[model samples]
Target: MRKILAALLLALFASTAAQAKWYEASSEHFVIYADDSEEDILRFAENLERYHSAMSLVTGRAIETPSPSNRVVIFVAGGKGDMRELTGSRWVGGFYVARAGASRAFVQTIRNKSGYPHFSTVILLHEYAHHFLISSARHSMPRWLGEGAAEFFAASSFDSEGGMQLGMPARHRANEISYAGIPPVEYLLDPKAFVESDREASGSFYGASWALFHMLIFDDARKGQLTSYWRLLNEGTDSLEAGKQAFGDLEQLDKDLKKYLKQKRMSLFRIGPDQLTTRPVTLRELPKGEAKMMDVRIVSQHGVTREEALDLVEEARKIAAKYPDDAGVQVALAEAEFDAGFNEAAIAAADRAIALDPSRPNAYVQKGYAQFSIAEEAEDKDAAYATAMETFSALNRLENDHPVPLIHYYRSFVERGAEPSETARHALERASQLAPFDKALAMNAAMMQAGEGKIALALVGLSPVANNPHGGELADTARLYVAQLEKAEEGTPWQPEEGEAKATGNEAKDPVAEGAAKKPTGS
Candidate 1:
């Protein structure tokens, strides 16, 4: 279970990183860091907030905001090329990760295209749409619909006068639409089948998705069909069956979609600032020292491989040498040190950071990580873990809703050879709630509940992973669990947190087995 929680965190959390001279803009939904003028970053943050509001209006769903620390963090690279280099994909304009403890997006100046003046913003928008939709609905959608809806909204616009266009024509998708054509309805419905079929033909997957979603949004005759299909899927119907039930005939629907794409002009849904209260965005330039280490911060946030960490920590150490007095730099050094497997060095750097700025949350997190890593090899494992738990507890006091603290709190017990107590189990569930987009964490929580015979809670927790639009082996696995549980008895078994837990000693020992460390911890 701790592996389920730690694997992702470790994969994304970095050891060393580079770049600097940054300004930060904070808003309701995002925190933007860029090496640009305050005005530019502010505008970027404002536009993102407006886009968030616009999505709420278009989808007719109320905003479900997260804790301030939990809001998505956006890093504006030096330019689009910079991000492309990081991702190692020339086709990628930008990218994002939505983790339980942290969510982040990265971009650079995007060149505009089509009628959309801000075409540069499309990548993050498309990705964010996926995050928002999945988080909001708490159910999976067909891959086609998920991507289609993201593209549809990604093509939208915000005029100088603050006017909003919800579903403008997706002219950016023209190349794909023309080359790949709309993927056949069957390919759209069955992701596995699509992958098994012609690769080149489905290259236009995103474009085809946009086309179909656009049609569904505007076609008067097909109005509400998408909703019907979504409802059916969530209600446990097979995707193709749901598609046929909602649209009647796939071949006929494909024909209609083909005809629909030929329209020289497509539908547009418009709204104005008067209809939505755009949240205010605040901006500030970072102090020179901290600004200089921002590249390190971004890379650390992006995560890296162990070998990669060895390369990065030197760069981080050099930056720290330049800004030895800076708390941010110290924190960066701590991350880099940890990433490079110098756990004691990381703990020391974290201590330096905390001494510099006691309020910094990540410093404590980094310290906790080093403590936990060190404890793994300690002869007095319980004593080492108890100290590690204190660091996370301090983080909890700093930001009670932070998913990392909640997760690690539960894990601290498990690591100590003791069963997690009622409070620890509840905290684990809450961590899943806070980071619903983190399907892995949710799955682990559900499995823990299932093991405890809390079938209903387990089912609820697993639902989102099963419905994840980016269908994968995990989604398929979760689907099996959901089906199996539903057939067993309708809420036939429920277990309390105290049910079978054998919480030992002082509670932070993770409730079992030091000798098992002689064995294996299967992730």
Candidate 2:
């Protein structure tokens, strides 16, 4: 029955196709998708690669280039309005989602506003700061620090000579700073106040957060205060007490930030292209069918609900049939089919993808996903499970460090009501380390660790999620995990309800909260 359905879908798609002049920019840290001119796409890709380089070197972080499959996939949105409409927010110019082994972002094309980098680029840069910092840090931090640092880094620019500047005054937040007033010092230091505040206070939080961070980073008198504060917090001190110890009087610190924000000229860093060494960016006009399928591919990569999948699978099938020889098109079809509950059809499409392009990694992932979906209902569960493992094993061989397959390895056992092997748990931990920006993945691993009495490790995993400035259920859930895990470390393990593991984080199901860097209520 499934085979016949699959055949009918392909038959219906036999002559369907669409048109778009799209370009792909492949670089060390990014895979860029743009429906724009080649010259423009190339220029943007170069700037992205250089920006990535500058950030890594400037921070003295040794973040290596991700595997091809792990590079952040950036989509150039139609315009600023499209970005705003995604989350129904006037303030959001762009956003990113951090999926293990498959992070992606959508942004309005970079442009200048008032002789500075546009708000779109600022939002993108701000989100990337969250991406980069979370990937490297070992523990959670205060919400103020996270937003402040992101704001400070987001206010940046690239020059014609390939030079870059950082720490510019956040002119984007100037209005909020001037009008919304400073968020009281307690708001900056306390998580409860940060979360409980209403819309106007939220705006002031960001404005005041940036002012405080910029002051700490650039002010001579505030040297080492930021480090001291973070160290105290990490050492188990409460945030308010840490702030007092590091910055002396809280009121004085607030006053200092107000004074700093009012200054006419603020200091910033200027580094030439020589200081930001980057890998070359490769650009090409996408193949006809692949170019035509950009919209479908973008939606699939970002993930979909069953309803969304139902809506998209027909278009995917049409494109796949029109471009029967295109592996990328087949991959898109496979994902659509899988998401729409056509598991057998998904496997068939993924098989075609693998045969068409042996080098494409996602084909294996599509097959593996479908295999996992159907294995439970199979008459011979053992053989079905083994076959799915082989599919993931093939992907691991292709990219040894690919995170999803490692996560799949861990999930294969737990999902089957069996105890995971030591090897499986190690694979999951390694995946968490490689993709710490995937806060959900870390949260899952942390839960497993907490269940097994590894409280310290669990805390490390949950901290970043708790402090996520995305500001919603996921952060709230993570804070709960931290509280529980900290108590467990102190000899009181709070047992979680059954089936709570998968329901903890704000995943793709929550469209508004998934991977959002800054979600101010309004204004």
Candidate 3:
């Protein structure tokens, strides 16, 4: 799925100097955040609205559009470096993250120099396709099919004269297919291989999958097969079996795919006029001080060096001085102070933010984290722990799907020297489901389960990390836990030696620390 690709593609990056301003605009289904001018932001919003309409037609499902209060957030960075700073990946063109019933996208507005049409638009649409599909359908599909569908829709183009084209040849994908060769359909269908693949394999997989889907959709005889395959998958059939039934013969389907790839020219689909929409878009600019504060918050969200942290704090303070009553600015200041290790200052700023806007969850998260960090030094640590837990509890109620709040809620029980209740167990499980790639969170859940003598459940939680050949320290730790669980099952007396079952130290122990850490953006 595109969500999995987003997680794998993200990399850690140190923070940069804070941005000075950002522009904002909105449409019925989307909000645009940019460092560009208002005109450009509005144009992007219009294009996104059109794209949403087009995708709804293609999927045969009406868009499950967000309400006025919860539009998808689109962050259009000024350049490549800005995009990299926000997403933590140098090569990522853009990505979408679904969080707490909202979707957020981070992308660069750079044009491709190789004469490619709508390069940046394609990237955004690719990510949007994932968001739309996930929102409209609650079912699952194979990774190859999901990604192939995204790429297929992403290649769509709208001419200035209002012509619409779909299924255009993807040149880059073709190149990858030519050089790397096509992977077997079985390989692409295997969800495990798709998730753990290396860069080269991933490229080939994407290319081959796209080509396969392109052929199936456009080749008159195979068009219906795509829908059939998806239907079978939805009915709980195994992907391989679904493919066999849908395509009739796996060997013949593979040959057809190879034949399609070798064609020098392919037919493109024209979108009918009925599929297009001409909805009006709305635009608004953020206040100057608030815009500047947004820049500070974005910078603070990424990991930062001490120097960068101090610089961000200074920048945020300048904005706060002008907009002293702004809750967002105060929250920005709190985040920067926490990053710079000024725990008490962070707590005070967070308190101010809460006083200004009681409904904002990030402020509570920051305040709770700062309190938890200093609890050990407090004269009444128990009271401090209780207060911290209470703050996180409020945050969880405000945004139940947010993994950070749930993570802190579970960790609070551990910090308070009490056995985690069933509530804590459910909270960790939900957090893990929401953020499967977070090795630290997964480790914490597995450790807690093992501590409760649920060795089998713990091993189930650790299996993915343990089997990850490329996983570094996390993989090693997971493997160790798996071995311990297996030994215990064998009736061998085994106790974890010193440091054998130690925490990763990277767990989301504090909500502020969790927010500051590199997580998949929007997630």
Best by TM-score: 2
> How many residue pairs clash in each candidate at the backbone level?
14, 0, 0
Q: Residue 437, candidate 2: how far off, in angstroms?
A: 0.9
Task: Give me candidate 3's TM-score against the actual structure.
Answer: 0.68
lDDT of 1: 0.72
- lDDT tens digits by residue: candidate 2, 80-166: 454543444566556687777778888776453333687777777887887787766776668788888888888888788888888
**Candidate 2 accuracy as lDDT:** 0.75
Q: What are the lDDT figures for the candidates, one per model? A: 0.72, 0.75, 0.65
TM-score of each: 0.86, 0.89, 0.68
The prediction achieving the highest lDDT against the true structure is 2
Residue 215 in model 2: lDDT: 92
Better TM-score candidate (1, 3):
1
Q: Write the per-residue lDDT of candidate 3 for residues 366-446, one digit (tens) a residue.
A: 787787788857788678878877877787677666666677667767776777789878888777666554455666777
Regions more than 4 Å wrong, model 3: 1-21, 26-31, 49-57, 60-72, 81-104, 110-117, 130-143, 158-167, 190-203, 223-248, 262-282, 305-311, 375-382, 393-407, 420-523
Q: What's model 1's lDDT at 492?
A: 55
> What are the per-residue Cα lDDT tens digits for candidate 1 across 1-523?
1111222222332222233357788888888887766666766677777788888888887646787777888887645455544544465556676667667777765332324845448777887887788777766677778778988888877766766787787877887788777778877887566663576766788788888888988999999999999899878787888989998899999999999999888888887888776778888778877776676676666666676677778778877888888898899899888888899999999999999999888798889888888998899988998899899899889888888888887787888778999998899888877877666777778877886877877888877676654435667677777877776554455332344322111101000000001000111
